[model samples]
Target: MAKKLFMFEKPLGMRDTLPFLYELKKQVRSVMAEEIERWGYEFIETPTLEYYETVGAASAIADHRLFKLLDQQGHTLVLRPDMTAPIARVAASRLYEDGNPLRLAYNANVFRAQQREGGRPAEFEQIGVELIGDGTVAADAEVISLMVALLKRVGLDRFSVAVGHIGYVNALFLEILGNEERASVLRRFLYEKNYVGYREHVKSWPLSSIDQKRLLDLLSLRGGTDVIEQAKTLVTSEEGRRAADELAALMAALWTYGVAEAVKLDMALVSHMSYYTGILFDVYAEQVGFPIGNGGRYDDLLAKFSRPAPATGFGLRVDRLVEAIGETDVRGDIECIVFSQERLAEAVELAEAKRAEGKRVVLQHIAGIRDIDAYSQRYRSIVYLLGRGGQ
Candidate 1:
């Protein structure tokens, strides 16, 4: 027989958000949504389940991690792993028109089946915006600036955005390694941030000292705008040069937006999202070990849905953002009226009046509570109406 499960046990990677935490998340979402709306982005939502053949293939998340199931008619379906792909599907099919860029926003829960991990969540909410159909350096700058703006609006002061160009990395790799297979090995090292392993692997290759040194130099490409100039020297191909130019242009545009101060150039930066065709970035908060948010240009994704457009966007992990913002004593402002039966009418009237005045009032019958003192402590203010008129 199978072992019985405990009542409080949740599925692997699942979590419960109690009232206080839920309120915090709600507040964060509210401010973020308002800020996004103020930037002229209209919020849209897509269905939770999508066909495995479509969005699932385009999502770039590992196939093993997708939460897949068969529909009643035997069609394969999956819970969306991220908002970007589904938004791409929607924009391509219905919303997007050629030459008119669409600014769309989403706030929803995405799912990815996790291995038996202790702290990773299988389901979490993402707040993000996608600017579809615009494919300029200015567009890239806008999304990054907006991301910085949203974080600031939500009271996050200590965060940095590291921006990079995949095109540059690819050009440099192809120019050096000469084939995708060799390039793939080094790319994995960079993705895992294993600089030591990257150096060892590059050294192990039967290349000249200069080539190996060039590969090793990719790690030091992190810093401010001058790093972009340093990056230009490492690549000889037109593609590589163009990528450097794009980063320079993006930096200029960001400076125009007054967000260049928060951004740094990382020529070696890469993402697991393989569809990122050009610039990409990750946002880090002071105390968070992982990125609180990330986004980049995915010019090829919308074409997978047959609506070719240049799109860029960012998604903030609500859980991580909340964690970065730290905690507060979220004792809500609530008033409670404890009434005896004789004073029930007065209590109801008071509650209604206070509620009409935008106050949170609870009308409690005194005898119903087992521990009145403990229960009363939950509210900010308490009123006792016992033993008749005006008491």
Candidate 2:
């Protein structure tokens, strides 16, 4: 027998946004868009579905998480898991010039299948910018500084950004573990922030006590500018030292941008996005348990598109950001006009006038509303044009 459908059932990890929440999101989006434009970034959009072999593979999202399908010609396609890879495709194909850096922004919904969780969204919106063609510490500093400016512009007063260099972390791991296979095992623990598991794994390994101590000391490299100095001592490789130097330079640039007070240095910070080759960072707010947004340097991604250039950017989850900002009521501005048949024309005229004056107006017939009193309470003000003379 066919299964019957429930009235209110929605797919797992999908959500509905009601009118109040919609208005709040609209306001937040508007404010952030203006701020991004002020910083010289032009907004662009890409298709929702891209060839699976191209964007889907390069997206850095796991294959199992991608929502894949077949097109009419039997070619595999995917609902974009993230905006960065798709943007890279476009930038490489059409936008990037020989030397000039491109600043592009996007606000769009991306999809990824949810396997183990019910509350996590399978489809969500992301607002982000990608800075392509630049490979300097200054480029890194600009993106981080801009992200901080956007959060502050939207009234986020208390939040922290944890900054780290992927290159440094990888170099340190290889110096100690001696192979990609062994290094990735410990790297997974850092990505998951399971320090206890990491410590136990290190202790169980056959490495010397001194090497184990060095690995354990990596966890403690989280704090202010002094953490950079501590990081330099732990890594003997030139690659590791250079990564530390880049972090130091980034911090100095951030100080000049005046956002250094909001950032912290975490030497062990890592991201699951393997494309990220250099610095990476995550932003967390006071109440949100998960990161509201993240971004990093992906100097290798554009090469997959046949245009090898440096790129870095960040994407903020709109839903998580709304949660971090707290609940707000944005439904009070609308005004309603209730009218009888005799006053229909008058009600129309009044609503149009109010709307022209930049007010939100809703016109309704008296007979249409079953409970006039309850309906009237929904708006900030109600106009009565019930009788022929207008009450």
Candidate 3:
């Protein structure tokens, strides 16, 4: 039997990023990782494929979104949809058993089987860090502060990290909806900002007028610093109150760390991922309709791997971050342009010398024809080969 050959083109939702754009994306990741490392996080890597049971542990990532496959033994595997879950597997298994907080960072590509909508790339680049073992609210504050500092350093003119605690949201939803599945559906409607869907879903539910109003209010609970105080009044459950207190404490820590202004207490900021057990946040910049960065405290994720540890991390979408920064604003002039026809060797020597001195040079070789003057327009100086029109 002959093996079948496949005709191919680059798949949809995947793209070849060109030179300048690619460099800009790299710069963004480098700056972010530098900032992350300075804050004590070490870099780590995880496999692209993992067992089905492991990847499926996180409730936030949908099954349909995963790029699934079967291995040689017929066991299921998947291209990781998110880095956190894989990181959790490693941390729990034996990578960080020192009992100290493990601070790790990664520059990774994640694959999603979901269709590309709104120009969303199916192959996404993520630059992120996970702070595991420390469950304190201060850890959350530090992570949030790092996010603000990172965005500012990356030259975002206007952006804010909208922060929320999932505990409060879970409690509030469970308080009204009374079941996880129903509450999840409502959470999606709110996350999508689809008020019509939310209303339609709520109409048939067994709840009072005041509770319905409260649910709508939850969706609208977003704004400046003052909104935190307002969230206090809406708390009906002890869990909600605890979440509010945690948020307040985080804000206080952020204020002390000089990043309070970069944050907005957005109670409406619930994430679709059920794994996010505590702080949840998204970064919104001007001109981009989607989040350029997001992550939250997932205290429950590691426990699924049999390592019960609290972890807080965040990931910045490298492509989105590059888009937010706009075009690369590089300024320079080529030091020399070597124009040569017969004297290719001379042109090469001149180019090499200039490049060694840390100057940009362009070498143009022709077949004893073509104007050197035409090339002079693009560079600062022109060098002639074999003394032809010697400058």
Candidate 4:
């Protein structure tokens, strides 16, 4: 009878990141956490599994895509597809009652069912921060500056923070359509970056020539501070104007912080965060086609858990960040590798002494002289014979 062969394989959209990549990820995360801490953000953690309803509110996560299961008691649960939702739930349940602006940070693994369009793993790491109870332009500006500093700290010299206003987009759509279903459809199309589909959908509506032009103009808005002025003319609702004003204030604040150069405004950036009600942004690095990080303001997400509080945050995809940083082999300084049989005790003592002095040392038993060269090359080690003395 032939032995059964159980093929080793990863589940679809998942993969095992080997040691080199894992180490690189660790380095990137360490730098990010260190820099974020410097800005006075305290770290927090949440569970990997959340109640299904907690994360299901975000339309970006389809029901089929969520890894859902029933607990032993028959309660529906899911592997959290995104950290923001669980974070919001936390704020509502625990932090909101405090009535203070909480600057919290977190580094955790987030599992998503969909395959990454950039050819990355489905289960990846996210290093994120949430600023709750804060809605001031100063807060937004600080967050953007901190994000830029983090990217620079992680060795990404060339990157852009694409800023947007979800409030502006929602306000404009509602002012024109008055129908929730139509606006929802338009929002989805814009979120997907399907400009062609958006235009086609708007064509069927009874919008005036001016409104039509404004709708298209909203999609066209992208660049720097000048984009804010351009957006002012296109906005027709009070919420739209407020969003534009917020963007202007945020830009001015960024200028004062001396980080304006790192930011780019894009009115069409409809992020997938359903709770986002104000300024939103995503970070993109040069030579990397996808965003390495993204975040925005969510004023009402906490209300679902019965404690309403304004909040904003950004999540850095550590795996993608590791990819952007590329592979870097870490080398260690070799002090000694002792080889001996009869003098094994002496070899061990010598290795211990070196280690006590904060030096790396390796101990091996040698059969004969020929084994020395082979062991040295195999372990990238330096061989020292006990009887022969130092060579």
Candidate that scores best on lDDT: 2
> Over the stretch 190-216, how does candidate 2's per-residue lDDT look in tens digits?
988899999999999999998898899
Q: Can you rank all candidates by lDDT, best first?
A: 2, 1, 4, 3
User: Scored by CA lDDT, what does every candidate get?
Assistant: 0.91, 0.92, 0.80, 0.81
Give the poorly placed runs of model 4, Cα more than 4 Å off.
Answer: 1-6, 55-60, 115-118, 331-336, 357-362, 367-375, 378-381, 386-391
- Candidate 1 lDDT tens digits, 1-391: 2456556789888899988999899999999999999999999999999999999999968899999999999999999999999999989988896569999999999999988757788999999999999999988999999999999999999999999998998899999999998888888888888888999999989998988888889899989889988888989999999999999999999999999999988888887637789999999998889899899999999989988889999999999999999997666789999999998888899999999999999899988999987998899999888986953
lDDT value, residue 204 of candidate 4: 75
Model 4 per-residue lDDT tens digits across residues 69-166: 88898988888877777877777777666688888899998776875464756688889888988878788888888888888888987888999999
What residue pairs clash in candidate 3, if any at all? none
Error of model 1, residue 387, in angstroms? 2.0
Clashes of 2: 0
Model 4, position 304: C-alpha lDDT score = 76
User: Candidate 1 has which clashing residue pairs, if any?
Assistant: none
For residue 303, what is the lDDT in candidate 3? 83
Deviation (Å) of 50 in candidate 2? 1.1
- What C-alpha RMSD separates each model from the true structure? 1.7, 1.7, 4.0, 3.0
Task: For model 2, state the Cα shift of residue 106 in Å.
Answer: 0.6
TM-score of each: 0.96, 0.96, 0.85, 0.89
Query: Any idea what lDDT model 3 has?
Result: 0.80
